[model samples]
Target: MHLKRFTDFALRVLIYLALHPGRTISINEIARAFDMSRNHLLKVINELVASEMIITYRGKTGGIRLARDPAAINVGALVRRLEGQAPLINCAEPLCPILPACTLKQVLNEAQHAFFEQLERYTLADLIGTKQEKLVNLLTNHVAGGNA
Candidate 1:
C-alpha cells in the first residue's frame, strides 16, 4: 500500500532529529534544509511534539529535539503512530458490495503486517551508515526542491 506524503514527511523529520540529537533544530533550518514550507513544517512539528516523539523548546535559544532516545524508537511503532490506526481495506465502511465477501481484507492485513514486520527490523540507528552524509544531502536537496 502506498503511504501518504504526510507519513513520509513525518518519518523524515523524525529521522533528521534522531540523527542530529543534542542539536536544537530550528524549524526554519529544517524548512530551508528540506525546502519545505515553514508553516506546514510547523504543523508537522507541532503534531510530533503533541505525540511526544519530539519536544519543543521556546524562546531565543529554543528549537526542537527528539523526546526519546533514537535507539529506543521502533520504526514500526513510529510509523503506526504517524499513519494512525491501520485499516487498509476499511471493511467497516466497505467501498464495494463485494467487500463483504472478498478475501481482500485478510490479504491487505497480511500485507500491512509484512510492512510493519520489515519496518520493525530497523531502528533509527539502522538508518545511519557510511552514506549518512550523502543521504542527508540528498534528502535536504530533494525536500528543498519540493520533490519528496
Candidate 2:
C-alpha cells in the first residue's frame, strides 16, 4: 500500500531529528533542508508535539527536538499511528456487488498487517545506522542550497 505524504513527512521529520541529537531544530530549518513547505511541515510538527514524540520550545531560542530517544521510537507503531485505520479497499463505496463474498478486503488487510509487522523490527536508530555522518552532511549541504 502507498503511504500518504503526511505520514512520509512525519517519518522524514523524525529521521532528521534523530540524526541531529546534538541540537534542537526549527520548523523553518527542517522545511528549508527538505525543500518542503513550512506550513505543511508545521502541521506535521504540531502532531508530533501533540503526541509527545517531539518537544517544541518558543521564543528566539525556540526550536524542536525528539522527546524520546531514537531507539525508543518504534517505526511500525509510529507509521500505524500516523496512517490511521483507513481500510485498504472501501467495500462500502458505491457498494461493491461482491462485498459479501469478496476475500480481497481480507487479503489486503493481512498484507497491510504484515507490512507494519515487519517494520516493527526497526526503530529510528536502525534507519540511520552507519549513515549518520553521510545523512548529516547531505542534509547540511541541502540546507546550504547545494546539491547533495
Candidate 3:
C-alpha cells in the first residue's frame, strides 16, 4: 500500500529533527533541505505539533524541535496517527460483485497489519543511528547556504 505524501513528509520531518537533536530547526530550512513545498510542510508541522511529536517556538529566533527524544517516538504509532483509518482497498464498493466471497480483502488486511507490526519495532532513533553525521551535514549545509 502506498502511503500519502503527508505521511512521507511527517517521517522526513521526524528524521531531520532526530538528526539535529537539540537544535531548533525552521520549517523553511527543512523545506529547503528536502526541496519540498513550504506550505505543505507547514500543514505537516501543524499536525505534528498538535500531536505533541514536535514543539514550536515563535518570534525572531523561533523554530521547531522534537517534543521527546527520538528513541521515544514510535514510527508505527506516528504513521497510524497521521494516516487515520483509511482502508487499503474499498472492499465495500458496490461495483465489485465478489466482495463477499473474495479473500483478497482479508489477505490484504493481514498484510497491512504485518507491515505496521514490523514498523512498530523501530523508532525515530533507529532511523538515524548511523547516518546522523551525514544527515546533519546535509541539512546544515543547506541552512548554512542561506538559500532558504
Candidate 4:
C-alpha cells in the first residue's frame, strides 16, 4: 500500500530524532539532511508534536526531540496517528452498499491489517538500532533542505 507524503515524512523525522537523541535538532538541519523542504518538515513536526509523539521547543537553542523512548513507541501506532484515520481503500468506509460483495475491498482490508500487525512488532528504536551513527551523520551533513 502507498503511504502519503505526510506519513512518510513523519516516519523519517521520527527515525532521525530516534537516532540523534543527543540534543535538540533544528528543523533546518533536518530538512537539509533529508533534502526536504523546511516548510514541509515544519508541518510534519507540528503534527507530531500535536500528537505528543515529539516535543518542540522555541528560542535560539530550542528545537525538537522525541517525547518518549524510541523503544516504547510502536511503529503501527505512529503510522495510525500520522495517517489520521486513513483507510487503505475508500471501499472500507461504512454504509457502502458494495461492501457486502466487494471481494477486492475485503482482500485489501485484510492486507492492510496484516501490514499494521507487522508494524506493531517494531518501534522507532528497532528502526534505528545499529544504524544510529549513519543516520546522525546523514542528518548532520544534509545539504540545504532535501533528502540525501
By TM-score, who's the top model here?
2
- Report the Cα lDDT for candidate 3: 0.89
Q: Identify the leading candidate in terms of lDDT.
A: 2
Candidate 4: list runs displaced more than 4 Å: 91-100, 140-148
What TM-score goes with each of the models?
A: 0.81, 0.94, 0.91, 0.84
Pairs of colliding residues, candidate 3: none
Candidate 2 local lDDT, residue 116: 92
Model 1 reaches what TM-score against the true structure? 0.81
Error of 3 at 30 (Å): 0.5
Q: What is candidate 4's lDDT per residue for 1-148, written digit by digit as tens?
A: 7778998999998898887776798898777677788899999999999888899989999999999999988999888766665556676455678777778866887888888889889999999989889877655655523444
Segments of candidate 3 deviating more than 4 angstroms: 140-148
- Per-residue lDDT tens digits for candidate 3, residues 28-145, read 8789888889999999999999999999999988999999999999999998888776768886675688886899888888988888888889999998988889888877787678
The TM-score obtained by model 4 is 0.84
Tell me the spans in candidate 2 whose CA falls farther than 4 Å from its real position: 146-148
- Of 1 and 4, the candidate ahead on TM-score is 4
Consecutive 10-residue window with the lowest summed lDDT within model 4: 139-148
What lDDT does the true structure give each of the candidates? 0.79, 0.89, 0.89, 0.82
Displacement of the residue 142 alpha carbon in candidate 2, Å: 1.9
The residue-by-residue lDDT of candidate 2 on 47-135, one tens digit each, is 99888899998999899999999999999999899898788889898899998899999999999989999989999899999999999
Worst 10 residues of 3 by lDDT: 85-94
Query: Model 1 segments beyond 4 Å from truth?
Result: 91-95, 136-148
